[model samples]
Target: MERIIGLIDMDCFYAQVEQRDKPELWGKPVIVVQHSRRGVQGGILAVSYEARGFGVKRGMTVAEAKQLCPDLATCLVPIGEYADKADIQKYRNASAEVFDVLNNFDSNIVVEKASVDEAFLDLSIYVDNIIEKFKEGVDLILPEFLPSSHIADGHDKNENDDERISRISTFLESSQNDISLLRLAIAALTIEQIRKQIRDKTQFFCSAGIANNKMMAKLVCARHKPRQQTIVPFKYVREILKTTPIRDVRGFGGKMGQKIQERLNIMTMGEILSIDFNKVVESFPDEHEWLLSVAEGYDSEPVKARSESSSIAVSKNFPGRNAINMVQELRQWLDGLTKELAKRLVTDQLQNKRTAENLVFALATEDGRPQKTLKLVSYHPDILIDMLWKAIKPLNKASDEQTWHPKIYNLYLGATKFVPGIPTANRDITEWLNSKGKKSSDEPLTDEIVFVHEEKKVYCPQPSTSRSDSVIVLDDDDDDEKEVPITEDDEEYIEVDGKRFSKTVFKNLPVMLRKQYEHKIALETARKLKMNAKSSRKRGNSLVAAEQSHMKKHKPLTSFFRKK
Candidate 1:
């Protein structure tokens, strides 16, 4: 069976998220930049198409972005508005929401999250079903299904969408025997639906690519982006990869790929086919034998869904001049991180129904090496602060409460050892609120905090002076170099009856959060009324028995004999 893979990449994810939440940002020149106390020196993380139209691109500083587009709307990666602390739980939450929608789209269609803004979906089952329907004369690839799809045939031609879809549908009807093309064409219809549902539910648009395998699907998905789907037929697979650079494929851009290119005298993926296979295998024996398979368009990596992260962490790099040794600064940053962690835990409960059992820390010193530590306490701020502070104190023996030497360059805080902590909608908020005092008193911290410093440390250079003032954030194409999106993970939620909630948006609500407060209130009120009526009847019966007992004790009534 031919595998039909679809990859969804969110366009300008950070900026798009900002636009989705704030209506005024629609159609504006929006840009996401990493903020620093150094002001507009922070680099641009993402650029809206409107801002891009003015020649603004990623890696440019906020100043340069605004210089190009004078009215550019600059949004900061809110690692911390007050301190250089980084916490981007919000982006992670958005990512979970996007993945949730895709995961729930079709049960048989397997979805694998490639990253926060990308997912790989295996549509083999859907394709097979569609093909079966086509054979049984019970199906038709309707024109409306692929309203915004394009074919990746190395063409620069454009046509009316209505004409193109109708034309494609007619071609598909006639080419029923060609299963290869037929499956992909049908897969495009499903891809269109996936895109539509994402937009309808989330208010965030995504671009999709459909191909025979993960590699081709990812490559073609990025072909036509922002809000479109591209289909690269099996016939055109080699044709497209003929001139494609190998660096575009993951894991092939590093030293290994360069060495292969130098030794094998190959640059494009298709060149591997032209070269001698035996010699190529001999040259790079251990590392890149799979290049040949991928070059031949035979990526067999299954699209498997990953379990929720065992750990949720937030880290910030101080980098050179921004490095901190002051005790006060360190405490403040840790406090900020803990607060972010606590908030994110709530989100995790709602999204994944899980929470952490222990707190973990990684403190990177000025030498660019981290001192890893683990603690016994839960995610509570005070316990974490006391425990994490004590854990750090032993390392900084030279310093006191005010300051320390050999300043810290990086800090990471996270929660791990996840246990189920479901945020049920029917959960009693009143009881939970009342448990705050007892919970603190009931829980105990008995385990001695453990610190395990990795004796093996690699020398990492400090962030250059230029990077301090104007750091350019890069694209997330390379997993090894992916920049962590930063902001408060305070869940995208609507408040109802003083409780925060994140839900699937039916309409006006932002995806993962909706406006059903009134509806919820109505149901809760009805439930309460039913319970109260039952209680009232029970109380009335008890009162009658008590009154009768009082009358019997008094013996003042003449007609007291009733029961035999």
Candidate 2:
């Protein structure tokens, strides 16, 4: 079966996301830049077409962008304010939503996420199924919302609607291009419908390129920009690649292309195709056959659905004067970054049910070479930071030996080599086999207390209690429960590794954690029950008093007549 692949690329994805969320930014020149003060020091993330008209491009510093287009709008800042921080979450969320729409289009539609803003769809099966259904006398219905078409094959969009319809009919009826035209037409219409659905659902516009393979599809997809698509026919494949430079080809643009040009003296796709297949194979043993196939505009690669990330990375940039110098500053930044990393690790643990087995840290400093370190199974930031210090200590000593001040600009922390944790449901079986209890390292420490009390009183620490007063001596089996005295002013406390927590704090903890404070939990629960009973009795007495007062205030008329 002939292959049909489509590449859908969102236009200025990050900027488009901002525009979709903030309608007022519509039709304006919006630029999305990385987080930084004065914005220009950090790199630009995306640029709107409106901003492009003013010569603003991606990767330009905010300062350079501002010089090119003074009216450029940054997604990080309000319309009138200065841009400071780059919020990347909105773009990430938008891309996921778009992928969801593509994923559910059809079960047979094999979609591959190319990047945050681009994806490839193998619609051969979907189109084949549709065509088969259509040929069986089933009436085909076109979507009510059709995307505006960009003129393909030298066709003029200004031409009359009737003339366009006539051309389509003639192409469909012609015997020479009948099957190809019908297939292309069906694929085109389906892609158009899908694009419309994406726009309707995501409120973001995208462009697509449909061809026989990924390489050609990606190359042709960019022919028309913003909101348009181009369908490259199989017959015109050679014609399209004839004048293109070898460097313009996907694989040819990298080191492979330079090698082919330098060693093979080949500079164009046409030249490479004209060369002997044996000569090419002998010269580039591993990539020889693949190179020839790509040169011929043929790719057999399938579009496979993307899986969850194997690694998670978090990094922070300290540009220009913002670079880290002092040890105190490094400590502060490390604390914040580790806290954030730990939070994300916990979240991923809950959602993905996977644990990272390796921690990698990279720091770019004045030395030009990044200080790097890799350790095993350090998920918590606090634990990972210790490993990080061991890695950086050598770098610090080297810098000290040189007697030069080190200015660190970039810090990278990545969790990789994911290992599936013992499944929550099957953990009991695994534990029984290993004869291991639950790991204490997995528990999160309560660094900051978030008190949620009904009385809304701020917890105040009293004078320190002696060991004798605080310690509650308990027998292994005590028939009589000794009540620990806790005044309204006196808070119940439990000491763990010398850290204290009140009974109120224990009560508010999750069930898993409540068990850890078993002694205090039991007492807290009983006290709450007693307090509730007392409150309920007070309400009952108040209700009876109100009824008696009402009866005395208005006596029954029959009772008054009998008494007289």
Candidate 3:
């Protein structure tokens, strides 16, 4: 099906809303602006059609607008005041009424609110259902063009004045079935129905367009006056766009459209469409697909409502060079932004539990050059702040004696990684330590273990000739149970039949001495296991007696005969 997209633009929305509340401003040039110095001069937020005729435009200062039309009437925009709770509720209520009316046509209709005033509606399905209603046959009749000499204003007439009037009368009398007239009548009736419904329900006036695509529809909608609609047939798409400037197309704005004009030397949409698609793509790499689609008069992209997960970012423009104070200012700004983001996350029921994958820091140069640096940060806010500070410290502390100190104008921060918070089996030890009064540098082992095992063992590795070198005999074993002299390197010792031996030689000792050494090792291992498993009601597998007995059975008598 040929897509029928409608761009419904409210004519001077703010101005109309103001005028509707205050009926005295009807049919007069009204401009909404901000009160400032130089006798109320700021961007023109909205301008009535009457004001637009007198060279008024949005973003034009009130002073400049007045210079263009000296008698222009002005009013301050109430958005800042009306953006409050009560007023926003009213605005939303009005918007809901508008949507409710549009929804009656088709539940499948896509409605996108471009702003308070403008919206794009995908009416392809709705149009398809009503196609039969507009299929009636009609004849085309062109209006007769009168010559200059035959027309007169207040001045005296020429000899052809009566002939011109007679021709116009005859043409009007002969043709009662002009196709343009019939089409316009149908369009007017349809638009009037919508307009009446909106005004009665919401007290707002909206202008609509009817065409096969968005671009032509938007253009036609703007062509007509307030509270009116215009229909562009599918056959007239080529002709209508032939002379339309490239900048006039929706989505073509500012530097993008200007670049296209400069590079392609094409002033109108028709000229752009006539060029090779590949050349257009090469010229505008960033918007190649969009330019090509517009040129072909085909757009399939659907309008969708905004989603929260799409983006969450914060940015600021600084005043001067990278001075010492700049770092403090940046930190302050980041704190404010983080606080706001945290509030929003809570409101949306989202968690910030995982580390952010991308942390971008954009730097705007004095000479219009763009440079940026990026780093990764942990999910914890404190850790993220520390990471950002470390990354920016070098730039913030650059010496004045070096190259030019480039003023930092812009900074941006964002988080790309998101993880849902779910309960897990393993708890993060570092996180738990940080939560308590303990520092991350604290040792994992107990103080007693460190002092007894580590400190005593280091001093036990010294030679002492005064100590006895005799080997002791064991009671349970024969001559094989003889004890070996303790060496300076051996710290552990075991007794066998009144004989002492180092654990290093316990394997060579008699059976009685080996069994005695094994028992000591088993006791020490079990003690450690009990400490670790204190919180568990069920005994840990590591504390099983079977495992301890296996180790005890392999100890050697000669190895256990050494002494410390």
- Where model 1 places Cα greater than 4 Å from the true spot, the runs are 38-41, 78-97, 137-144, 154-175, 253-259, 262-265, 306-310, 357-360, 371-377, 397-405, 416-564
Q: Comparing 2 and 3 by TM-score, which wins?
A: 2
Per-residue lDDT tens digits for candidate 3, residues 1-564, read 456566667767777766775788888888977533224355676798889899899888778889988888887643221111011222333454466565553455566665556667765554333334434532322222211111111121223446545543443333345433233323333444555566765567778776666676676676544665555555455666667788887766677788888988898866777878789878987887777667655556676642124344555445444321444555665555443332232222212222234555555556453434454433334555666666655664336433323555655666554444311221111332123325344533110000001211111111111122222332332423344454454556665333345654444332322433354456456656664564254464444553464445333212222221
For candidate 2, the clash count comes to 2
> How many clashing pairs in candidate 3?
16
Candidate number that wins on TM-score, 1 or 2: 1
Ranking by lDDT: 1, 2, 3
Q: Which ten residues in a row have the lowest lDDT in candidate 3?
A: 447-456
On the 0 to 100 scale, the lDDT of residue 296 in model 3 is 54
Top-lDDT candidate index = 1
Candidate 3 residue runs with Cα over 4 Å from true position: 17-28, 34-41, 68-105, 130-192, 254-256, 273-293, 305-564
Task: Write the residue-wise lDDT of candidate 1 on 274-326 in tens digits.
Answer: 88878877886874568777777778889897537767777777888888878
Candidate no. 1 TM-score: 0.69
Whole-structure CA lDDT of model 3 = 0.49
Alpha carbon lDDT of residue 147, candidate 3? 18
Full-model lDDT for every candidate: 0.63, 0.61, 0.49
Each model's number of backbone clashes? 3, 2, 16
